[model samples]
Target: MRAHPAVGDCLLALSLLFVDLLVLLSQARQHHGQPWYVALPLDVAMVAPVAFRRKYPQVTAYVILVLSVPHSALQLGIGSATASCVALYTMVVYVGRRQAALYVVAQLAVAVLQMWARWAPGITLIIIVLIFALCWVLGEFVGARQAYHAEVEARLHLLETERDQAGRIAVAEERGRIARELHDVVAHAVSVIVVQADGASYALRSDPAVAERAVRTISDTGRQALAELRRLLQVLRNEEVTREPRIPQPTAESLEDLAGRVRAAGVPVELSIEGEMTGLPAGVSLGVYRIVQESLTNTLKHAGPGARAQVRVRRAENLVDVEIVDDGAGKARALVPAPDLPGGNGLIGMRERAHLFGGILQAGPCPGGGWRVHATFPVRLDP
Candidate 1:
């Protein structure tokens, strides 16, 4: 059979029942000689509240106190007074300190009056007071430990919530970073491909040799763009990073090859290098390459017929500078003085790339009928 939750408590309360029973049977002459039935109910009332002392300590104490009056006045057993002492102990352990203090004071005052009425000796009264004081101190110690455990649990819950919040924020930031990388890779390649396809279509009948070269350039640019796209998409997989060999990103050395492809697309391109390309940080190299690549792509799309482009790169002791100018049909599309608010994805992506590496971009229309993009960055030794 399953034991009940209150079984142990009932057994304790039953022990006190025997104490009052023994008083009634062996010490009947000490009272006014009341019968067993008359005194039985009074004894039961006193110990009944003991079973609920821990659940309702203050209520139990008050109930025991009220019951004691008739028990004491009618010359019944002292069970009610004894039960109140157990209530006092529970009060300190479970109730607030102020309530415990109030009950304790009330108990002591009644105890003193009882001792004085009985004319008990000073030593006996002192012993009773000492025993109650010791129980009170023990209850206070248990209360302290209970409060400490509760505080620790509260702090642990708060820390767990903060940890989950930080993880979500990190995931959101990684997603944004991936979006920017995809835009830079796909936008630049698709622009070059579109321009080359147009040139190939027009030159197919009149200039067969030029058309063939544009087709080959388109094929090569498409393959390179595909490889870069695969690298960016790898971040989404759950596999370990080492599962695939890493691909090197494009740097400043790739600019000449890039300009060659743009020239192959029918635009006149002139590339110039003003400073040493060595000793630049990896991020700076990548940022510079993307900036130049994107600016040239924009010129191919926006610059009108008979347009020519120039790319200039200069490295200094503290910074690296870049300039791209195109003399195309500019007045038709107000490419200069780009709106303070970003005009398109191309403009927004360019600014994001520059800002990622502590750089600044200036883009606007040139008075000579074209658009120009200028950017500069601190040549960081370490990323």
Candidate 2:
């Protein structure tokens, strides 16, 4: 059977009571002759209340004081008076300071009256009061110290919890940023490949030359997309590596290669440059490349077979503008059913990549029977 808390406390109180009683008996035996019935019985009555001292400290203390009177009156064992002193000490230690103080004054008065009536020594009264005062002060100091330590520990625990919460918030924010980057990379690449593949598939049966070009376009687009994906993964894996190798990244300079691939996919792309293409930042170049790739890919998928596409890159004083327009009918049957392009995350990716370069992208069906994608980036590169 499980023991209740009170039962455990009672058992400890009993054990203390036994030790106190044994000490009292031994002291009495060593100093005084064997006591008569009055002394022995009175000593037992004074010490017995100590067993319940923890449960009813004030009551036990008062009972010991009351019983001390008769035992003293009958000239009982001095050791019995010592047992009453032990009970008084227990009360002062366990009970509140205010109550213990009041009880101490009452017991002192009683002790004084008894000693006066018997003509006891003045030195003994002074010694007994000094002992009681010392025990009371020590107990109060220990209790206050325990309470102070507990408060400090509670505050430290609260601080640790707050620190953990802040760490979790930071980690969640980082994950959100990483997810956005991944979406931009995958959407732009996949959208372009799908459009090129569709155009190539349509030209395969009728035009052998066009069909071969389309196949080559699809292969090149797939390879470029894979390289971009690998670069992104590498950056994520070794985040602490401050310096990166100067690997070649597809940028505006590579537009000719991009146009060649798209033309091979059976979509003829006419490219035009209006401004000097010098001293462009790497990030800006990459952004421009992705925008054009996405636009041409969309043309291949939505413009249908035999679509003619136009790509223009114009650099002004503070801005660079890129525009792609296609003459084929807008969007294939699958894209038309779901204008948003079901399960396609391309358009969204393009916009995000453009935004990263401090630019804006616009893509939709033009007033004419075709589609257009235009992007503008703020130029920050030094001339």
TM-score of each: 0.76, 0.48
Clashes of each: 3, 4
Among all candidates shown, the one with the greatest lDDT: 1
**Residue pairs clashing, model 2:** 213-264, 214-264, 214-265, 302-331
Alpha-carbon RMSD to native, per candidate: 4.7, 8.8
lDDT of 2 by residue, 204-267 (tens): 7878777676666667667766776666566556653346653466678888887876675557
**Model 2 alpha-carbon miss at residue 175, Å:** 6.8
Off by over 4 Å in 1: 1-95, 116-136, 240-242, 274-279, 335-339
lDDT of 1 by residue, 1-383 (tens): 12663675566678888888887886676654568887889888878888887677889888887787667655566677577767777888889779988987887777677668878688866776787787788778878887898899999998998999898898887886677677777877887889888989999999999889888988998999898888877777758346988678889888998898888776888999987776788878888888888888878787866899999999987889999999888787564355344657777777877787788988877776788888888875433
Evaluated with TM-score, which candidate comes out highest? 1
TM-score of 1: 0.76
